[model samples]
Target chain A: MTRRQKRPFVVFGFETTHDALAAEAVLKAADLRVVPIPAPPVLGALCGIAMRIPPESAGRARDLLAAADLDPVTRAEIEDF
Target chain B: MTPEDLERAAGDSAVGGVSAYFDHAATSWPKPTGVVDAVVRALTVGGGSPGRAAHRLGLEASREIYAARTACAAFLGARRSKDIIFTRGCTESCNLMLKGLLRAGDRVVVSSMEHNSVARPLAVLARLGVEVVRVAAHENGTMDPASIEAALSAPTRAVVCQHVSNVTGTIQPIAEITRIAHNAGAVVLVDGAQAAGHLDVDLSQLGVDAYAVSGHKGMLGPQGIGLLYLNPELEVDGLLEGGTGGGSETVEMPSSRPDRYEPGTPNTPGILGLGAAVAFLGGEGAAQRDQEQLLTQHLHEGILDIGGYRVSGPAPGSPRGPVVSVVPDSGTPPELAAWLDREHGIACRAGLHCAPWAHETMGTRDTGTCRFGLGYGLTETHVDMLLDALRVYRS
Candidate 1:
């Protein structure tokens, strides 16, 4: 039930929505609080969905994803809504 | 062509045989009208290689394929569609997973009721130095998860098991086995060839590293297309490498999901057909499974009443799929199958059913067993006809 934060937050975009959804499942399973949100127009997301993570948890989220062997192509911070 | 036209054409075909089909386990018959329509549309209209370009047709094909992937992912309880990779069929999917995941000298545990798809690959792997241990199922063809735990005497790399036995219709306790395997630091792979679309399969809840399914079996799809769902975190080498349409600049295969494993041109029409079939199943799957279970339970009860004919696997009222295997005390399986077809015009599958080990476990390897696989189209009338034919042979 986490929503996209209006403040600066890191978003991870994958090649496809499926990948993003998959990563979302794993990150949540690992107890990493993240939400799947639409890519900001600035991010040029390849897919429709992207995982939004709090800036503080970005590193841990990436590590958890890497452990599971999923690599996100775009890991950028959304400065605004 | 329209479904009505296709139906008329099928009716017009000169081919004549048994009036009722009871070989759903081999492949579902009389696919949904939408399946044929989608396939036809894919063939006649949606012409282009998906992921090849941004051209109109190419994009359309890509969209269709992706939509199918999404549908399958949702249906199978996968977190995302990208986790599902398309293959030729379940056999190829099994081979890809086994060959790509297991290395020589790795220890893997499997159930004794596995079809040749799993058994053959394990056999080949055994020669390459992989130690394969099979946990025997009960006489009813159900594997006890405790047996899997016991078989893990040695540290294991993986545990391969079927969600449902194709030959026995016994549903395996996958969640318990998956937990046991995970606790042992082993990955779990479930062969859902006969379970998906027929049973309630929630991959996320089941917690398996991989789940393999066939489009032709219970999914109500056409043959020559299968799906292999790999946990995005799991690393598996591509079975084949070629043009994936993307990453054309580099000879190295695109190190990404689907494209990572799916190399070369895909079965566009088949995938679309499967998508249509999946959609159809989504609407009718529950009702179909209930009807099939009721029919199978009835068949099991009738087999018991036939008094001398031995029913394979779990007894009536047990957790079972739509498959039912029967062994007669006097006649051979093939002989009985032939008699049913010639004398009673009832269609069914007979013999080892590609699981010689399962038959051997059931003590029917020498004589094989007649398998009656009920499908969504089969009704109580068909069951009564089958029961009547079976009763005639009882004397």
Candidate 2:
């Protein structure tokens, strides 16, 4: 049995809310363009609030958040809400 | 709380929807949206045990814990985030600092308004050859710095004082006390349990050697998480020693800032919630504290207007924290509190509030006192409801 592929939208799940907020602030400042959505429930607990970015801006958003030392996003991704 | 929220929270009819929570001293309720979500996230998505290993989950958990430390450090105005150590709660933090720092034949100065958290530990130490001197508190629950200075006559090793009185909401002048203690070459350990989110506390400015706070009280975080700010210059032995993610190679506990203190697995979810709560409180604490002050004054004036009632703690306009203790002439505090809960759905504490020393100082040791600790999101409606309840009870 083969598993289905995740959607094109990249969601960054944070370990804590402050980390998500920090990422949100940096992404907005850098004009990377991301929207916050409830976690898709696939990932484990404590990262329920995640930042969703378009596939095009995922790289830039990741860069901005990384620069702030807020690498809260996990390796997981989801397609939609 | 909204009607929908109340309906959801009142799932159990026996509990009777708590219309208002005036027990911020015990633990704050209706935490920020981020706090609840943070806890949920940790349980569901972030399941790593922090400081245990370098695995993915462990690393993520460690990041969350470190973020909490940084938040607490910024909240307390510490020089660096590394100085903050996480504990079970303010009570444990107090025990760690007092038990680890004090030795036999050491003389310690404590305020009469201290909670049992500080008083009991000192009491046990007293039997073990530790000299404990208590500076009496004024009727209004304020500790006179002059009395503390006079008591400092004998050489003391340390001074333990609460930044705010949990029973009476009395705000002590800690900066002055810290200065006096430091002048006599004594280290100061401030119990900031009731003061952290209620007042502006800057460790560097206060110049205290150690400060401890409960994250769930004024900080609007989940319980089971406490913060301890130890000035790096001060050397206090660790109360507990076990597995600290680092320094496993050495048979002895590693001499480090936090690793030396934090042993065993920590409450990662609680710490994450605290980090989120502190972040939510970022830069807006002064405004929130000011609002609570206004509410406190409003409650004080309202209670006074309800004839035959006497309110304790600092007067209406005086500099104070958000807690208020009331003594009605007609009924006992527990009776009034029960009526408030059963009849009016109001929640409050009616007892010594774990600060028997404070009640003793206030001369209400026998009857105890009904304490209303106001916190975030408490509006005039709740205050009015409480006032109306008190008036009805009197009638």
Candidate 3:
């Protein structure tokens, strides 16, 4: 909920809220840490929920999502100041 | 005597407060075990704009809704949660299906025992140039697939039918009806208000294009929420459109499966309560159905033991929903219901029961019938309580 962070994060955006929730379930089950956040304006996904993950876990999360067939609509790197 | 005195007299014990509630057809009482708790929890703990914020509360609310959608889909025998659309109630679900599918000059086939939910909207669609065909139900209150097939002789746009008659409790042969309609290349939509919680409805195997259900009645959930299972193949557009928390920048509503149908802020609390209701169904559904049928049979047999009462619809042993509507030979329907409520502490629905056409079909249009709709938590003791009270009518 803090406005700023010390480290950059990887965000996965979805076209639908349900889809985003599905991805969250998959990543959480794989023992990866992720936070569900409002999709940033830069993603241009309209109104959607996106999952924020540590940059280190992005590869593992992507693998889990691919196997689960939860294709994220947009993937972006949110740089932290 | 005061109404409180009647309550004590009917309780049958020192703890005399429970009246025999026979109005499950209108809405199920004592909403299972978890419905109220879930609703309260949603209001108390589950807060924030779901899918519209990055906060933990917002994410949790969205998760609960998504979980509910999955559970509801499974309960209704649907394959994908994306296909399930939540509406205000069954009436709204019916309105959406009718408005979204039919066009001018298209024909829709319906039954004689339909509730106003279907008949009323079809009447408006009829005025708009849709050819409405009525399939006559047999006097026993069951629909004959042959009659439905006959109505489908001409090319029809849709066949709208009820899975169970709300007034008569006669379960229709929906699978057969759907097959008949599909053979004629017509879409099938069912009024599942009385059937969803009362019977085993497997939508995947049933193969109907759309089915609408009430959460308050058989599902034992909140009153404002209901469900519609739309076949993924059906291409009806959203009946009403607004913010769906998806694709907001688009000039139109989101093209997502259910979001296309659901607009504006979702009913998170009601939807969560409905979720808890269906989850209860997963374990207790068969037991609930069995208990309801047993009590219904007891009431039916007891009414016949008294000389002046006539039970309508299917025969006593016929497999039907858990509803019993009877006409008393000695008194009017309202009079019997009032007497039961005032003295015996039993609650019953009397008169036309909101289906005038169904009453006409049964030849009880004028006198109407005293209806006792059974459900969970009712036992043989309640049936005995009612039967004992009816013995006074012996002449």
What's the TM-score of chain B for every model shown? 0.96, 0.96, 0.94
- When 2 and 3 are scored with TM-score, the better candidate is 3
Per-residue CA lDDT of model 3 for A1-81, tens digit only, reads 777656889999887888889898899998888888777877877457888899999999998999987778789999644
Name the regions of candidate 1 deviating beyond 4 angstroms.
Answer: A1-81, B1-14
lDDT score, candidate 1: 0.84
- Give lDDT for model 2: 0.82
The TM-scores of all predictions, comma-separated, are 0.83, 0.81, 0.92
lDDT of 2 by residue, B1-395 (tens): 34355334433335557777788878887777788999999998998877554455765876687778877898879976768888989999999889989988999999999999899989989999999998899988998989888999999999899999998888999899989899998999999999998888888899999999999999889999988888888888888888765434456875756777887888989999999989878855456778898999999989888877778888888878899898889989999889888888888999999898898899999999999999876777778888888889989
Compared with the true structure, what per-residue lDDT tens digits does model 1 show for residues B1-395? 34354334333424575467788899987677788899899988998877655456766777688889989999999986788999999998999889989999899999989999999999999999999998888989989989999988899999999999899899999999999999999999889999988898899899999899999888988899999999877888878988765444467776778888888779999999999988988885567778888999998998888877888999789989899998888788899999998887777889999998888788888888999998757778778888998889878
Worst window of 10 by summed lDDT in candidate 1 chain B: B5-14
What local lDDT does model 3 show for residue B234? 91
Best by DockQ: 3
Model 2, residue B193: distance off in Å is 0.9
What DockQ class does candidate 2 belong to?
incorrect
Please give the CA lDDT of all the candidate structures: 0.84, 0.82, 0.84
